[model samples]
Target: MPEGLIVKALSGYYYVQNSEGGQPVQCRGRGIFKNRGESPLVGDRVLFSETENGEGTVEEILPRFSELIRPQIANADLAVLVFSVVRPELNLLLLDKFLVHTEHARMNALLVFTKMDRIPDDEEGESIRRVVEDARALYSSIGYEVILTSAHEGEGMDKLRQALAGHINMLAGQSGVGKSSLVNALVPGLTLATNEISTKLGRGKHTTRHVELIPLAGGGYMADTPGFSQLDFAELGIDEIGSCFREFRERASTCKFRGCTHTHEPHCAVLQAKEQGEISESRYSHYVGFMTEWKETKRRY
Candidate 1:
């Protein structure tokens, strides 16, 4: 028996990298896994039996520290949410959803603003500054790190790499925000397919179809995922959603109610901040919208 980490899953095959064995072992789970109703996911650490055929059967799946439903991976160090400044514009609703989802998984969220070169600084600097500042104050206030990146003119690649240098990060964003391009830049010859953003639709074609971990040059690895338009938030209840907004949490604690939903609560600290312009109205609006959507969506189930 040996222990290994499930690094990749493809074509009904699981690739496990065994440290003790010093090699990747292609393996499948035994009937015990099926009987116990356990299926392995990428980034999962497991115990297995090494077979003579250079493969093995997974016997046990170690408890996952965190799990993300969108990419369906476990034990991620962080999630990089990439979005473009122009082209498709920023989707606040989707961005909030991703943030909440990442927090629910107990993974740190890194906001990456990509395609900055496309939106020239001369034309979009002030606007971009406001957006970056608002995002920084909004997310950073919630304990997340927000980074600016540009794959076109290579603006923030070094900073982005520095952030991901020692962490196992998962890259996500709306399709065509250059998630793949960033990955290509980070890994160089890895060359993940990148597509042109459609002028008519203002979105990029899906270049990555499935999640794959690419090992970085110095250390660490990154998981590349397909572009997504919507994410599931019904699993995250409204009461626990506030802490996900780092900026709002401190002010939120001052709300009149112990479990204030920040909507319609008397003397709500969160709403007070919104009115005082301490928190961006745009972000607060998105929070309310997310709660409303979640409530409606949950009622059906």
Candidate 2:
């Protein structure tokens, strides 16, 4: 059997990119997969056999290093948390949510702050830059790389590319954060639909309805997905929430309780860190928000 990477799956068809590097071979999974309750996902390395009609059937899925259950993408190495600095403004709360998901997925995250050119050269611009710097410092302190880029002027794109190169990167952010624009800047002429009706797909601008991996110039492959705003902690437990925040995880060991929720616990290291300015208040707030949601969601079940 020949091995390949599943780059895209649409309407029950899996487009497997040949391992040797050529046009993707359209393939379908065997009926046994359904019987076994297993399905192929984009970014899955698969063993498949070519059919007489040039299509193929996946025989087996190779073991994945990491899999994101929410988006259903497998083996992604990094999540490029795309956001904008000016227009819609940067949402620290939302960025923290993405970070938690990326952390849970066991993948590195890169913060790409887009739309630098759109920032007005005035007092307001200074304020925006201040927030951006703050976010960059906060996330970088937790070991995430932050890159500021102006898609209009192509500034900082090289750095973005360098971070993505040779890695399975996933572009994840809310709509209107310039994810498409940044992808366009990185790969010219391959324009992605930016929330507009796409004639080619005959669908609305969410052409990436299903996650699709676009081949990059270098060895890297990027999974282009629909921009979504919300990530409910449906798959996460209340105890698992604290570990999602990197800073919280670091301080949790010294917490008074072995399995501290970090909420009103006596001698909690995480709370102490927040009071002592060791942890970002914004991140801690998000953690509380998630815990609340998780508690409510957990009770409903």
Candidate 3:
């Protein structure tokens, strides 16, 4: 038996990349897997045996440290949450939602702001730049690696590569945020499909419809997943929601009551941090909003 990583899965076939460097072997899960209620996912490490036809059979799936349901990837080390500064405009709330999901999944996250060149070089652009910068600062303060990238101009490409070095990363964000462009820039000669934003709808068509792990030039793999338009915390509890916010979680220890939801609670350390500007007000607002949303969801159910 040989061990390899499953890089792609499509139509009952799994493409397993060899650890010793060769063409990815086409494989199919063993029938036992189906009987056992186990299916191989991309990013899974497995033990396989090659058959005479030059294909392989995935015998067993190794343990996975992390898994994402939407993209259906396993054992990812990082989630590169890509966003744009303009043209499909930046939605901080959506970005935060991605962060919340990433953190909840116990994966490291890198926030990449793409299409920096799209920001005009004028007074208006300056204002927009400031807003982006401030948001970057807020995320950075909470210990996230944030990079400003422009795939067309080659800005921050090196930094982005460095950040992705030696880790299985998934590029996730809204449609038209240039996730494909960024991946192309990071891995040369891989011209992944990219779409222009719709002027009327203010969103981009989904260019990446499926998830596949593309080997990165810098080392490790990047899973380009279909862009998402909406995300809801339907599976997370209200208390779990607050814990996803790093700053809030840290300050939550000081709250007067145990299990503080960090909303409308007197002597709440998280609220105090918001009042003192220790936490981003926008972030806190989102936290509170998610809390309310989760509560309502629980009530309705």
Candidate 4:
């Protein structure tokens, strides 16, 4: 059996790109996989056998170190969380939601602020720049790699390329934030379809509808996925929510109780950190929001 990476999965077929690749071999999952409650996902390293017709049968799916839920990719080493400083407006709350998901999935996240050129040269632009700077500072301080980018001027393209080299990255963000444009910039001549932002709605229409890993010229791969605006923590438990926030997790051990929920608990180190200006109030608020949602969900279930 030859081993290859599953670059695309669509309509019950897996496109396996083997080491001796020409075109990807179209493969179908064996019955054993269904019996085992497994389905092939893009970025999965799979073992398969090819027949005379060039179609193949997937024999096994190797272990995955990381997996993303929304885009349904596996073995991705990084998630490039793209956002814009203008147009759609920087939604720190939404960005924090992405960070929580990225952390929970056990993959490194690189924050890419796109559409830098759209910032006006007037006073408002400067104010927006300050806000973006603050956000970059906050996320970087908490140990995330933030890269500033402008698809229009090609700024930060080199840095983006360098960070993506030798790793599989999933490009994700709200629709119209230039996820497609950024992909085109990083991989020239790719010419991915891009849509203009709806001025009335302040949102971009979805361009990339499905997930497919594109091989980078330098090295590694990037999956351009359909942009989405919302994420829910319905799958997460109340007790598990705190671990998603890296800063809170660091100081959780010092709380008064071993299983401290950090909500109205006495001598809670996380709460103390929030009061001492250590944790950003916005992030703490989001944490509490997730906790509240989880609690509500438990009640209904």
Best by TM-score: 3
lDDT head-to-head 2 vs 4, winner:
4
Cα lDDT tens digits, model 1, 1-301, are 6788887888767788885647688888777777887778888888888788888888889998888777888788888899887777866678887887776677887899877776655756678667666766776765667777787678888888888877778989999788888888888777788888899898889888777767777677798877887776677788768877766777877888898899898999888888887787777888888888888889988
Model 2 pairs in collision: none
Report the lDDT tens digits of candidate 3 across residue range 90-209: 789888898899989999899999889999989999999999999889899999989999999999998989989899999899998899898888887899998888999988999986
Please report, in order, the local distance difference test score of every candidate based on alpha carbons: 0.80, 0.85, 0.90, 0.90
Candidate 4 per-residue lDDT over residues 78-151, each given as its tens digit: 99999999988898989988888888888889999999999999999999999999999999999999999998
Order by TM-score, highest first: 3, 4, 2, 1
lDDT of model 4 at position 108: 86
Q: Which stretches of candidate 4 lie over 4 Å from their true place?
A: none
Candidate 1 runs further than 4 Å off: 20-23, 121-142
Per-residue lDDT tens digits for candidate 2, residues 1-301, read 8899999999999999989878999988999999999989999999999989999998899998988876789999989988888656788888888887888887888899988998889999999989889888888888888999998898998888888999989998877777777777788788987764244542233445778898778669888888785788888887678998888888889998888899899999999999999997888888999899888988898
Q: Which candidate model has the greater TM-score, 3 or 4?
A: 3
RMSD each, Å: 2.3, 3.6, 1.1, 1.3
Root mean square deviation (Cα) for candidate 2? 3.6
Clashes of each: 4, 0, 0, 0
Which of the two candidates, 1 or 2, achieves a greater lDDT against the reference?
2
Q: Which window of ten consecutive residues has the lowest lDDT sum in model 1?
A: 116-125
